[model samples]
Target: MTSISASEGCEKGLAPGHFAPETAYLDTASAGLPPAEAVTAITSALTAASRGTATVGGYFEAAADARARFARLVGVAPGRVAISASAAVHTGLIAQSLPAGSEVLVADGDFASLVNPFHVRPDLRVRTVPLERLADGVRPGTALVAVSAVQSADGRLADLDRIAAAARAHGARTLVDASQSAGWLPLDAGAYDFTLVVGYKWLLAPKGTSFLVVPEDLGGLTPVFAGWVAGEDPWGSCYGQVTRLADCARRFDETPAFFSYVGARHSLALVEELGVERIGRHDVALADRFRAGLADLGRTPVPAPGSAIVAVPGLGTAAGRLAAAGVRVSSRAGGLRAAFHLYNTAADVDRLLEVIAGT
Candidate 1:
């Protein structure tokens, strides 16, 4: 079996000491372990807050800094990114913007946060297609095509390039949920009309931080949830109706989560320093190692080439046993879901394999 050495697994800025020594954590698909820098930043923020030294201005600044860093990571202008508390909130904004009776195309079994808003609208026509046929399912009447860049249930990769092209041909807008792909996958937020990402899963930020990217024209989305923070000058516009909304995507912003952003700034900085391309290579290598071990044990995971997530059918019940044995993973869609990231190594994969073998 191929092995990735400790030196190869541990990037310069990301050390093994960043995580707990006893846990073989392969659950990055659920939530990432924040690096030491992020932990320190959050702790310092909390300390200041306790002493009443934490300023709202400082919090906003940290959020802005994190926003800029995220924009750079996803290859979009900062002006196009809107900060929100969750992907579902941003997805609702898009769903609200669509005209009643407009058709929305989505992949079958896509994350509920991405598909639920449209389904609940009642006035919209929501169509589900197999992920492999998502692009071909587009038609002239389709108002939007929404999908995840990587499937959360089975780690299947969506064909973004094809979907984007098809959407353009049909004059339909595109919304991509990159919550599962952002940290380890190289992405261009500019490729779609709308892109949504929740930071906790892969970007390593706290739960309340999320981002939405919209076209320069705001992609005709109405800022239904706009509040004081969405005003041209938030502090100045707090009392009355927002006399003027921000000219850019900030008009879609929710009030920033101060503490979350404090940690997010540092976490995103670490991601930038390590670089996405390098992280992608490292993550996939470990995932492939896991896949090889699974094959040796006569288990075949859902086919996801070049992906860092592996989901094995009929092994969902093993999750509890694996976790008790100190190997952390998730059970999703009646399968065992193991996600590898920058911090995972060959030893972690082997540890999971050993646990699975015993089970």
Candidate 2:
């Protein structure tokens, strides 16, 4: 991994007046703290909307800009991206797009949204494999593979390049859930037939801001529920004109939360300005520091493939203890999950270790 300069790392820390003086937020895997600029953008948009100063054209202009930025970040064409409400919604769409009776393989440690879509369909088959044994589970008969870029439970990184190659050899499509890795890790959406991204986690945006990437090679995806925004001539079809739907992924767009898109636009800009590679290095280094600190407390971290998240036993107890001391963390996957993001620092890790050691 490349090293981030100390000055750059410090610049990535929490913005001024963003958090309480004594608080250390370490649960970024669940929901990121929005940047101050994003908050301001959201409030400004909401104010305009309530005052009837926001126009439909202006709302969609911002949405289009957001989609373009997301496309640039993921290395895909803007037309291949569709603004979505959440990951669960896109998971179901991809599951339904596949032929009936297709085999969908998912890792046991993946988020529930990856598996539940296929589970509810009687015509489709869903199977679970251990996170460590995911590649071995793919076979010729498999029709689709769904997994997270970073396992939500333990922060184990998935080898998407390897998995995509294996799936392609077996004539299967791959749908990657990038919710856990998007803003910090490099992602090439063009490599997969489908990719789901949610903004609240690493993107440092609020809920209601998410998107799906669907390449043309995957074929037309039937909208599970076509709203007024589903066709090429969206406004024209409002009066029952019976227009054709779009050939691109935009056909699947839902009526988005305009204010959320405004905030997401600014958040994406921040990540772009910082450069995802630099943020990745900063986050991994902090995670390493946190793991080393836990080791000093005589606690061993659960082994994971990457440095995005560090899990150790007694997570529930540790979370309570840390909370009592005004430090925030999450208990997940049978351990204390301390997810590191760009906002984290060595000082935060030191504080967590001090609490854990009862010092």
Candidate 3:
């Protein structure tokens, strides 16, 4: 069980003045609220792009700088990270690059983005289990062990360190979907072999944006669908000539939705300014608050920590009644799930607990 320390709520992040949007948003695990500074940065970038600043001067170059900024926020070298239109784009490319006749291990709780690619590939073999059991499922021939760093529905945090240790013992690589844990997970990028994360969830970036980090020593891994954008010298040909595929992170692609990049870059900057550790603590604390309040109502709640996600056993009751009463939550595994983000406060949890009791 993850325990959150309540005494650490200090005002040390992007500055409260920069955190606009007075509305209380409790669904950050789904989509985070962007900070005001990041919004301004994105808006300025978009405005300049519309005026042909990007196309006339240097297309994607500015975006590249933004990707570098994002890499810094996530604790990965800029060269090892690929900026993309969405998290799935990076994962799909990796999935397509799997070796012939390779079997992959996945946790049953993976996000749809990670599972769908395997479904489309008939040649690939996939095995799903509870996340705790995923590392044990890895075998000598297993090409990859993919699972979310944090469970999406219930905020059940995963032990990636243990999973990583298990994969290496079996000669398998690991791909972590940090979409649920990126902005909040306690570990640095160096801790995982490969990680895919999106700006929409934890970073509070706009939709249609994210990044992927592939280690410098990819161990012969190559993206089968590598495009011109992924090149190290995308335009080294000097005139309409192609450059070699980038040895670093750019290998993911060259051209992406620049507007989305701008949005994500802005969001990431806010996360960095706030300090990843601080932001993580804020959400973890809120989750603890929610669980405490819910427990007071005699509700069964999962207390595990790592991410802001928390779960309440449905207790064989319909979850709709609670949702209908101004409570924002989801029903999964015959239970109710509540996620916390910067926008959520202890009051939100208290209100949710009150509603659950009346239901």
Point to the candidate with the largest lDDT.
1
Please identify model 1 stretches exceeding 4 Å from their true place. 1-7, 10-14
Q: Which digits, one per residue and each the tens of the lDDT, describe model 2 over residues 1-359?
A: 44467345643363344433347888889998888788898888889889989888777777888899999999999889988878888888887877888899999868987789889999998889886677778998999889999877778888888889889999888899999999888898999989989999898878888889997753457787566677787777676643687667888888788888888888888877777778787788788777777777788887774557888866666788788898888998668888878777778878888888883
Judged by whole-model lDDT over C-alpha atoms, candidate 1 comes out at: 0.91
Runs of candidate 3 with Cα error greater than 4 angstroms are: 1-5, 8-15, 48-62, 235-243, 315-334
On the 0 to 100 scale, the lDDT of residue 56 in model 1 is 93
For model 1, state the Cα shift of residue 238 in Å.
1.1
Q: What tens digits encode model 3's per-residue C-alpha lDDT throughout 1-359?
A: 23334434422222456565343345676677777766776688778877867562233755676678777876778878777767677777877888667788888867888777876788888888887787677778887888888887677777778888888888788888888887766547776778888878887877777778888876355656566665566555334434576777776663666666656666776666666676677777778777777768777676575557887776425446655565566676777777776556566667777776777
**lDDT minimum window of 10 residues, candidate 1:** 4-13
Rank by TM-score, descending? 1, 2, 3
**Candidate 3, residue 263: how far the Cα is off, in Å:** 2.4
What tens digits encode model 1's per-residue C-alpha lDDT throughout 1-359? 24344347643324466655458888989998888888898999999999989889999999999999999999999999999989999999999999999999999999999999999999999999999999999998999999999999999999999999999999999999999999999999998999999999788888889999999999899999989999989999889799999999999999988889998998898888778877887888788888999999999999999898999999999999998998999999999999998778788888899999988
lDDT of each: 0.91, 0.81, 0.70
Candidate 2: how many backbone clashes?
Answer: 1
TM-score of 1: 0.96
